[model samples]
Target: MSRLKEAQKSSKGAAAYSRYINRPLGRPMAATAYALRMTPTQVTIVSAVFTLTGVALIALLPPTVWSSILIAVLLVLGYALDSADGQLARLTGTGSLAGEWLDHFFDSIKLATIHLAVLVCWFRFFDLPDGWLLVPLVFAASANVFFFGIIAADFLRRVHRLEHPHGPAEAPREAWRSGGLYSLAVIPTDYGFLCLVFALLWWQPVFVGIYTALAVINVLMLLLAALRWYRSIRGLAADV
Candidate 1:
């Protein structure tokens, strides 16, 4: 198969929105990155730069629609680049443990940083309830635990050469393809969609409603995911 085609295949994600949308958006950039002979780590770094720049701008800029929109655009670009790096890695046959670590590290940073950035925007601008201000912080902290648990569980399974925990009995389903209801549960946690959420920040009610809803949903989902992964790991160990 051609490199581009292979890269295209590699772009698919477990989330339907990602497979259908984000991956497609990133394909052209993946081709570009390939042409430029960019390394996966370099692509990862560039992705972070774009994403963090957007987050920083959101925190620093005056609370205006224009600033919010620009931040949204930057974040969308960052998400595309994020998708591109893995595709680039697959295309170049440069997938490495170190490269994987770097990719995951960047992902974790944004997991926390994005929420913190939003909190900054709120604290600096909005007159939200003091208790409400803690939601983002809660999300930031809980999300890390979720991520760490998931990754650690996967690592243990890999090291143990255990069977894929959720096989034919519980086939993997893309969050988007699942249903609108399921998608809503999963989508808000997505950084790609979170970019769009920033645009709603200037509108207080819309922003707060979304922020609180997403935070609660995402935290619950993450905790459940972590629990599922932990159970899988424990089951594997028991079988041993």
Candidate 2:
């Protein structure tokens, strides 16, 4: 009887770990927003507005390095809002497919605007030589690729969860701990962090290098997600 009890405890721990690892970081904010009577759509619109303001400040302001820093700060706020919208919806039981799709659509637009703002800043203020715009352009494309890739991967993960109601046993407890750490790591590695780093290192071409590397990784992540999604659907079809 003791052994059976121990085994059950272990199983429970493992399931808990898996859930912690797979969870996103926006739940708290979502809860707060829901308590405050904000809707997901409202949060989404507010996030976009903040992001647009950041881009405009960066592009149209006087040629000062401080402006870049301010823009970076605003960009971070924009990202936080972006996270809060979905969270609020989930917490408030107001989540819908249309809201999710619109969130993604606006996310892409926000990314594009950020890149364009950076390019305009460099071109207008820094006065780079001809063809220098290509640098920001490349970085921008990479940023978009990363954003879209992450979204795709998340969608595939959700679909898999839905289809596999009871596939295999849950993961080990250690796996969940590791996954939580990985999610935290995303805070430093995300686009907002990249932008802040670029602002600080604008004097060098390191920003360009960082952007390129991030873009490449984004593309790879997207491809892996697409493959996983395809496999999940195929497996479901086979069962049917």
Candidate 3:
């Protein structure tokens, strides 16, 4: 297989920006890291640095059209690097529990704090009413829950598979094959979409409207997703 093909993972439930844009960007970065003989842990740290830097910028800098664009670039680059680390691990055959733990640790930190950074920016910079602050606060909470729920679901699936090795295997998911419409449908839950939304930070009304809408949509999606995941996980026990 070509290096890119070898590094590619199943898209499965990934949202549009990640499935289509970030993973492709990361593939070449993963190749470059492999050529440099970099470890996945190192790439992970670098990814965290870029991501945290962007988070800090949102909290510290006054959001301008230019600064917002720069923030988007940094966050997007960080996200690509996040993708690259896993691909690099696959390429080098160096994937490990520690590496996965570290990757998820950083992701948890990012998911927990990125929206809080927005909260800080809104408080420190935006001239909004006090009630508006709740948007980011609620967003931050839901985002962390969303992130943890996903990882927990995956962990449970892994354990279920190990426990049921002799039982029937799972049917392969067909979500990715549905292509464009499914991808488009999940855009609100995509981090890359949120990153791009920062580009409108110069216009507070527009930014707030879009951001608030996304938060509401994500919260609703998370509720529905959690229920669906619960049903699926319960089925694993029933099948056994």
Candidate 4:
């Protein structure tokens, strides 16, 4: 297989847009990174630079036709680079615990700050009811919760596996999440889709409508996921 094909990750539980679009976009970028002898950590820093720059732009500049598109492009590129770092690590056998930590650290910062940047942008530029300003605040809280929940759940699962190496595998339960319908159903939660949404930032009303819809969907999804994750974690504790 080609290097790009070899670097591909399983798309089983990934959102539709991420599985179909972002990963594919990252493949060539990963290949390029590998060819350049770049470390995964370096690539991750580059991702952070792109992402943070876009976030800064959102807060610092009034949206314009051109600026909105630039923001979208920067975000999209940043997200693709986020995927590329992992692929590069996997391809080059350079994966390390520190590298993983750095990746998640940048991601946590991104998750915590992106919506705050939106809140800042709206405060500075958009003319809306004061009550409407709460949207990004709520969304920011939800995003952080979602990000932390996933990380915590994964850590707990790893600990459980270490404790019970021969326990029943999780594949059966995970199978449902791997399905195409599950992937499609979660597209609203995909960061790649959110990056694309920034392209409409110049249209304040449309942006607010879609952003509100996304915020609502994220809260609902996070609630459902929290319940499931709680049950799973409780079960793991019981098994210990």
Candidate 5:
């Protein structure tokens, strides 16, 4: 099967088993908005607003288990908004260079703020053991490092492709599947999910452990991507 087909199949299977109940609802709304002539950039901006509000709410809310639950709901809404923006952009043919840049910019802000808000809540409202704040900060920093590395690697890959048009082209199918995985590398959504889990479990330490592991994996993936880009460029130069 082509890489695209394989990726579609994999994604379909994942969606089938996903615990995210809002996915189905999100798609139709995205489609409808696209049909209504809304640009992806608009949707992305809206999503960012929601995300910022959610973070602010979390930080300012009174300390209680219900507050955590409310934050989790907001996180889920933010996720849906994130998905909708991209989908709407693609469906409406409103994708652009500016839109892409804006998407990444807002995404970085959203990710950083979410964790920052959580850390604030933990420090100000709840009393955790000493050095607990460091856990979230470390995880956030590690995630940002990996995110930056991936962006650099992607830029390198594009340059390599431009330099060598015929140098053992990546299987379009594998490229598609890998593209999804690489997208995951960009956002560290897993880290956000871990934060939510930690909030629910009240196990701040365990959340740190999970985020640390994910950061390591993300860094490794970035390294692999960089290596691939280097090899592709080298192969192109050799051909020349």
Candidate 6:
């Protein structure tokens, strides 16, 4: 099997887009990193460089033929590096709590930064309605809040011996989330999909429509997940 196929075996689980697209695309790089004996944290720092570079371009540079294409490439590189870091960790058995925290912090900043960049982009150039700039801010909060909720649940679960702090939150086996057609569904929260939207900035109408739709989906999902988590862990909630 290819390195990607090997990496997939180690994937605990992921949303469809990550399972199908990002992982597969990142296998070769993961293999290369392993061959080079690179540490997971090193890969993460490199990934941050690529991600922040892409964000800088999208956030600061005006639309140009070359800028969009270059931004797309950088974002894709960042994503591949992101995938490789985890795989490298798993492959080398260097996956630590500290490393995981580092990775999540990087993702959190990148996530917030991208949305704010897009907000600026829209305000400066797009033909958007008044106050439409606030849409991205809402999406940013929704996504981050949902992420923090998951972390809180996982931490509380660990405290109560519900699961190990470092073990699988679900089952050991792959399921429907690993399916190929999941790309379409995962677009709602896929980092790559969001980058694609930025890359298509020349088409302001399409970007605005997609950005707003994604923002709404994120808010609804955040509420639904938070409610479900609260209900499921009501015992812990009461004790706290």
Across residues 69-149, which tens digit of lDDT does each residue of candidate 2 receive? 777667766776776675566555678999989898987887787778778877776655757777668667766766666
Q: What is the lDDT of residue 211 in candidate 1?
A: 79
Across 1-240, the per-residue lDDT of candidate 4 in tens digits comes to 277677777888899989988988888888888888899999999999999999999999999988999999999999999999999888888999999999999999999889999999999999998898899999999999999999999998998899899886763457888899999999899999999999999999999999999999999999999999999888877765
Q: Which regions of candidate 3 fall more than 4 Å away from where they truly are? A: 174-178
- Estimate the Cα RMSD of every predicted model relative to the unseen true structure: 3.7, 8.3, 1.5, 1.3, 5.7, 3.8
For each candidate in the order shown, give its overall lDDT on alpha carbons.
0.77, 0.61, 0.90, 0.92, 0.60, 0.76
Model 4 deviation from native, Cα RMSD in Å? 1.3
lDDT of 4: 0.92
TM-score of each: 0.86, 0.64, 0.96, 0.96, 0.70, 0.84
Model 6 Cα lDDT, one tens digit per residue, 1-240:
254465455433356556667877777788888788889999999999999999888878886667877887898889888988887887777889989999989988887788888888777777778689899899878877877898898777667554344443433334654555544565687777776666776667776888899899888867877887786667544544
- What is the lDDT, from 0 to 100, of the residue 195 in candidate 5? 33
* Candidate 1 deviant stretches above 4 angstroms: 8-13, 162-185
Candidate 1 lDDT, tens digit per residue, 66-167? 888888888888888888888888888888999889889888888878888878878888887778889889878877887788689778868666465553
Please say which candidate is ahead in lDDT: 2 or 6.
6
85 Cα displacement, candidate 4 (Å): 0.5
Worst 10 residues of 6 by lDDT: 163-172
Better of 1 and 5 by TM-score: 1
What's model 5's lDDT at 193?
56
The TM-score of predicted model 5 comes to 0.70
Ranked by lDDT, top first: 4, 3, 1, 6, 2, 5
User: Model 4 clash pairs?
Assistant: none
Badly placed stretches (over 4 Å) of model 4 are none
Collision pairs in model 5 = 3-173, 4-173
Candidate 6 vs. true structure, TM-score:
0.84
